[model samples]
Target: MTLFSPLHLREVTLPNRIGISPMCMYASQDGQVSDFHVAHLGRFALGGAGLVIAEATAVHPHGRISPFDTGLWSDEQVPGWRRVTALVAASGSVPGVQLGHAGRRAAVREPWRAGAPLDETDAAAGFAPWPLVAPSALPAGPGHAMPAELTARQIAHSVQDWHDAAVRAVSAGFRFIELHGAHGYLLHSFLSPVSNRRTDRYGGSAENRLRYPLEVVAAVRDAIGDGIPLSFRVSAVDGAEGGSGIEETVHIARRLAAAGVDLIDTSSGGITTDRSTDTRIRRGFAFHADFSRRIRDEAGVPTATVGLVVDAEQAERLLDHGDADMVLLGRQVLDDPNWPHHARIALGDDSHDSWDVRYGSALGPRARTLARLTASGETPLTRFSP
Candidate 1:
């Protein structure tokens, strides 16, 4: 896809397909954002991303995977997030936040701490990992606590939490909202049979498993109104034997569209104990051709293809072939914050004048000088941001 083409979702127009994926920052203090987050997301906006989804923020404190996770459950978080949204928007990129609940994955150590399970002492200090909740009483891995099955009341409260979070996101100046329903988190736990084994209405059959996720989407949409674009990131397949499969994910996408989802962000795995079984299939290459195409053609909703999607040409081909509406770069963008600028050149949008106007001033050169350098392939380069 041409990085600069407008992507219309409701009233919002993304300036490009190049979006910064929601990578967990784990920099929040007591679920409150700090200057670190503002600088992190704001730089992407300034770097020329058309859209910037803030890291996966929890809907409630207990829903956090670690004590450092951002939260929207309190009004106090809004002001800090607003500071970030304003900075991102000032640079012309749309601001967004991905709301999620970690469920059985909750209360773990930060990624820098190796993301390990904590003990009772750690839990008492507010870092202690404990039994998580899910559709069933299953644990994510060895040494992880087997979660408790959620009651109907708990499920209802969870939906309300998402609804409230959406409202807060909008108030914080976010134009888009994405529910983090993938990666073996709370919503994905319900969607995948590998973790969700309940016989209640929220489990067992595929329809039942999909119910909670769909409800959260509906609730968020209702909370945010039709003017804002709402999206859901889903593990299109569990990548596990007899786990949530393509067909089930497709069905879930269809229902999500009907329930007011603007796009299906297709991701996989994170719901199983075994990721090695399919690691060789070219990471992030699983659903682009088959599942994403099926969902877009059959369900008639735009889809965002994620996972290992980095190369500019590969993303363009996926869009040209009508497989997905948008390509979300995770690690690639992480590795190169200026990926969009490079992609613009690759897609033949190489108006050196435009790119320079956006970035070259930071290089201490006049537009004409930068253009001359770019045309001559003699622009001096230094170490790029990762």
Candidate 2:
């Protein structure tokens, strides 16, 4: 099946379409990786994800959405990331990193905490939330501080940060890199009119709104050369009134595809305060399935459909039906990192012998039982035993 086929881009080859969605561990200290990151990511690779994307990594100190967010802004962070890439690659999964800048969403409290906007007191205590920068001075929430409007010079610098981060990602042994243009982050903020109300060249028209992000993608392509694949994760809509629509996203995706982006990781919403609509389609649901297909058909760029995509049949049918080229599992992968291994069995590949020898002895019987149960429409491996 196309879903299980190898995805070849440049010199980078994903062994399978299964990708570990970049999930923030929030376990870093001063933007440095700890043992938690190593173990957390390493296990997913071992569990058989073809592509393991490290969590959203901030390109600058203040660009972090929270104090615990990982960073690739400094040279010191590369060594910590190297440990992760090495392990993932050793497990045969191509390791990648998602480089991002949180923009107006930056410097907030960690999710486990209240996630309330951070204040000067927090910044002074070393968890300080600095004034976030965005295309407009929009605050992400009521209590969130209104961000300072980024000047052209600062915008240029921000683009440079993305370029630099791409270089650092390669140095850290990542074979693939994706720009975090999704989920109301920096690039998404610029794309959505609700968040970017600037009259400058970086805003106003759709072309203007896409200028900054396109420049960033171009810069990253220049830095990383043509050997590795670069992807862009985009929030296909703002979900607020007058927010960007799929027609606009298709235009952006077309340009990005021309500018050397390999795949478009399609996700949606997060520009405005409208979480109601966002919640309705939270699971592996692409808001504009037809639109995504149009992008792949017309623009000819491979797409990765994410958000609430659960189960092998749904993922396989997505590719089988021509909706997207790949399926990215986020929370589902978290729920079971070995989902791919199980999926391969369900699809009748007969490669059950490919399970890692370390775990193969036990997995053989377990895979048989799971596949048999799954055929009967029951899953007994919901909770794995250590």
Candidate 3:
């Protein structure tokens, strides 16, 4: 398999394996996506991402990591997403959305402002800190507020919350839905031993810890139905002591597949907000390949690997070597929305056949001109060589 190869997940056939990783823009208002999100996401689709998954959208308003995070909790938010999905589909890319709950990690500032928990100083600025909920009553970090332990009744309600969000996602025109069970999020918190300190059926053993997230999976699947594809993103390692490991994640992947999840969006390290104890895999090219490879092979499920996958050859090699079924690009794609189209050129599609005609019609000729100039020894610095 190559980077440009098509991937069939259920009834959805991605024209290529490259996908835009769901990176939160934190630019929404009242959980509604704005014009900024439209241009931001649509550009990637127009640039040639086979699948464009929108950022981690909260299922509940309080589930938001920040006041600005997108939400699927209400119908009001669905119309905004519809505009985005329509644009992505027009550009021939499948639109997807990642459903998530921040858990105890909620009520924080954006990453630009140090991502600290909101305080009175911020509350005065119109962003009030909200209560947090988790598997146990614990704070995410030093300055974070302590979260209330979710009762059995609340957990059941939360499960339905996910179901309702998934239903909203479908209505919003997303063909694919991914559960963000990574990065210290509510779902990940429950899965990790470090975060889940509860004594009930939802906590103690590994099986118990997986309970809440699995219920969510079932709920989402029931909401979206058999025709739509469901993907689960997992923090393959908790990146903290006394937490689940790769082997445990592989087992989780197996269970997820059994629960009707079509793919595992393999990621890592969000189980703790404590950087002091962080042991996440280093961010290198295709860093999550090992985790994804193990899950795909051991659990016999399709997996997508992300993290620092910047180059065309690097992404292609991951697929060629069976590291993952697909590769998701985040920062790299953000840097150049047309990375997929550029990658096509790098991988021998020199005529810009894959790029949208709007771009290809111009870039096609530019390539020939540049090549001709190079053959004639006309480098940018050549004019000064004399």
Candidate 4:
């Protein structure tokens, strides 16, 4: 299939193979999406992305990566997300969201603020840090505080929280729901041997480590029903010493597929806070393609690959070569919201037929005029050139 092909997952059919990868904007207030979200996300839909997955939204307040991250923990957050989904749907794109819990990575400042853990000086300035939780009481890195180990009751409560958030996501008009099981978050913390040293069922063995995440997945699937597409984002490799490798991740993907997950959004690393200490795979173009291809082939699951997927031909090649079923773009789409439509033209559909009527009606004529100028051996910047 080509990059412009449709992807059918459960009852939803994405208009094209290009998807907008979830990237936290960190622009919310009290976990509510602001005008920035509507404008920012709506533009991607309007720009013609087949699937538009919003940022990593927390399932609970304490799970937020930063205080400003959006959340779906309460009924009050539903309507705000519904606005996003409605606009995206109206633009002919499927609206989706990634549900996440930052775990020990929570209660931190935004990436621009150094992404460090908050301390007393920050609390005095009104951004107080909350108590972090994980499978074991461990700090994410050197300067981060050691999080409290989650008790059995708390783990059960967290599962219910994920279910409740999934219910809210359905109410918010999302057709697809993705669980953020990567990036050294609560789920990843439990999965990685480097981070999880617990003696409980939620740790120790690989099967035991998969326990909590699978329970949450099953619960979320039941909450959202069978009609919605469920995706799980996994760090294909933990990129650190004693972390889960590709083989371990394949087993995890198989379990996730069995638990009713429709797609595996393959990503890697982020299990360690110290970049220097990370033994991550090389950061080449389409870096996660090999991992995604393996998971899709061996585990028998559809997979999405992201990382340096910056162009139309490159995205097409990923799908064309069977490396992934879908190609997800992060910064590339941010650089050009209309990358999908532009890609359509670059891939030989130059009629601009895929663009929205409002923009195409004007741009269609502009494109012709430029082509005519070039044919006449005339250049718009020729007068200015030395």
Candidate 5:
């Protein structure tokens, strides 16, 4: 199928294969989305994204990566999300959100400020860092605060939190729900042995590691019900040495599918905060295609691949060659929200007919005007040419 082809997942049908990957904007206040999110997320739908997944929203207050990250932990957050989902749905695009708990990665500064651990200098600015928690008591890195290991009772509580957040996500009008289990987040921490040093049913062996994430899956599925599609993003490989590998992640994907996860959004790395111990995959074009293909084939589940998917031809090639069932773009779309519309032109839709009528109606004539100008050997700079 082509990149513009529809992908059916349970009861949801994405109009095309171009999905906007969840990228955190770090612009909220106390986990409440402001107008920035409405305009930020709404434009992608208008720009022709088939599936628009919101940023990694914390499932619990302590799960936030930064104090400014958005959240679904409280009912008050629902109205803001509802505004965004309604705008996206009006364009026939599937509105989705990636729910996550940052775990040891919680309480870091915004990436622009170097993602350093939040300290009292920020508390003076009224953004006090909170305690971080994880599967183990290990500190995330050199400058990060030591996290408290999650207790058995706390683990049970965390599962309920995910369930409650899923309920909130539905109330917020999100049609597709994706669990952010990748990039050393809470669920990924439990999956990789490097971070999960616990000895209970939640750690050690592979099966033990998968327990908590699977429990979350069941809880979210029950909350969202059978009709709504559920997706899980997995790291597929850990960044640190001796951490979980593709073999382990593939096994995890299989179990996730059986536990009601409808799709595997394949990604990798970020299990460690230290750049020294980091073994992240190279940022090549469509970096996660190989991982996605393997997870799709071996695990017997549909997959969406992300990372450096910059252009339409490259994205279409990924689907054409069976690299993935769908392609997700993050930085590329941020650079140009109408990248999908441009892609349709690049892939032979010269009429711009599929674009939002507001844009396409004007764009089509402009394209013809440009074409005519080009036919007359007139470039914008040609008037000054010798």
Candidate 6:
């Protein structure tokens, strides 16, 4: 199948294989989405994105990555998200949301501020640092505070929170739900031995480490019902010393598939905060292809490859070669919200018919005029060139 092909996942059909990867805008106010979010996310849908997944929305307020990150913790947040989903759906794109808990990564500043953990000075400035939680009482890095270990009761409550958030996501009109089980967040922290040092049922052996995330997947799956597609994003490899590898991730993927995860959005690294100690995989075009392909084949689950997937040909090649079932674009789409439509032209469909009528009607005549000018051996820049 080509990049433009439709992907039928459960009861939902994505209009095309190219999906907008959830990239945190960090523009919310106390977890409430504003008009900025509606305008920001709506553009991709208007620009021809087949699926638009909202950023990592915290299931609980304490799980926020930054004070400004969006959340779905209460009913008040539903109406705002409903506006986004409604606009996206009206634009002929499937709307999805990623529910996440940042765990020890919480209470940090935005990426532009170097993502440093907030402290008293920031608290005085009204950006107070909240207590972080994890499976073990360990800091994400040297300077970060050691997070409080989550009690069994608290862990159970967190699972319920995910379920509640999934219900809210459904109420907000999202057809797909993804659980953020990656990047050294709460679920990934529990899965990795490097971050999790607990001796309880939620830690230790690989199967034990799989406990909490599986519970979350099951809870979310049940909450959203069997009709909506459920996706799980995983850091395919920890990319750090003593971290889990592909084989371990494969095991996790197999369990996740069994637990009702439909797609694995393969990503890597982010397990540790220390840049020096953090080992990163090669940053190449479609960097996650091998990881995604392996998970798709070995785990027998559909996969979506991210990381440097910039163009249509590369995305099509990945799917054609069985590297992934879909390709997710993050920064590329940010650079050009209409990249999907542009890709159609790059792939030889020059009619611009796929574009929304408002854009196509205008652009179509301009494209023909340019072609006619070129055919007549007259260039628009010929008169200006020295």
Question: lDDT tens digits, residues 79-151, model 2?
Answer: 9999999999998899999998988878777777776678877777887677688899887656777889999
**Regions of model 2 farther than 4 Å from truth:** 120-125, 274-291, 365-386
Candidate 1 lDDT by residue in tens digits, 55-138: 889998878988889989988899999999999888888998999999888878877777877787776776656457887888
- lDDT string, candidate 5, 1-386, tens digits: 39889999999999999999999999999899899999999999998999999999999999999999999999999999999999999988999999999999999899999999999999999989999999999877789888899999999999999999999999999999999999998999999988998898999888999999999999999999988999999998897987888988889999999999999999999898888888887888888899999999999999999999998899899998988999999999999999988899899888788788888899889999999999999999997999
lDDT of 5 at 192: 90
Pairwise lDDT winner, candidates 2 and 4:
4
Write down the lDDT of every candidate, Cα atoms only: 0.82, 0.84, 0.93, 0.93, 0.93, 0.93
Which regions in candidate 3 have their CA more than 4 angstroms from the true location? 379-386
Clashes of each: 4, 6, 2, 0, 0, 0
Candidate closer to the true structure by lDDT (higher is better), 2 or 3: 3
lDDT of 5 at 363: 85
Per-candidate RMSD, Å: 4.1, 4.3, 1.3, 1.2, 1.1, 1.0
RMSD of 1: 4.1
lDDT per residue (tens digit) for residues 96-206 in model 4: 999999998999989998998998988998889999999999888888888999998999999999999999999999999999999999999988998899998888999
Score candidate 4 by lDDT: 0.93
> For candidate 3, which ten residues in a row score worst on lDDT?
277-286
Q: lDDT tens digits, residues 171-230, model 3?
A: 999999999999999999999989999999999998999899899999999998888989
Tell me which of candidates 1 and 2 scores higher on lDDT: 2
TM-score, one value per model: 0.90, 0.91, 0.97, 0.98, 0.98, 0.98
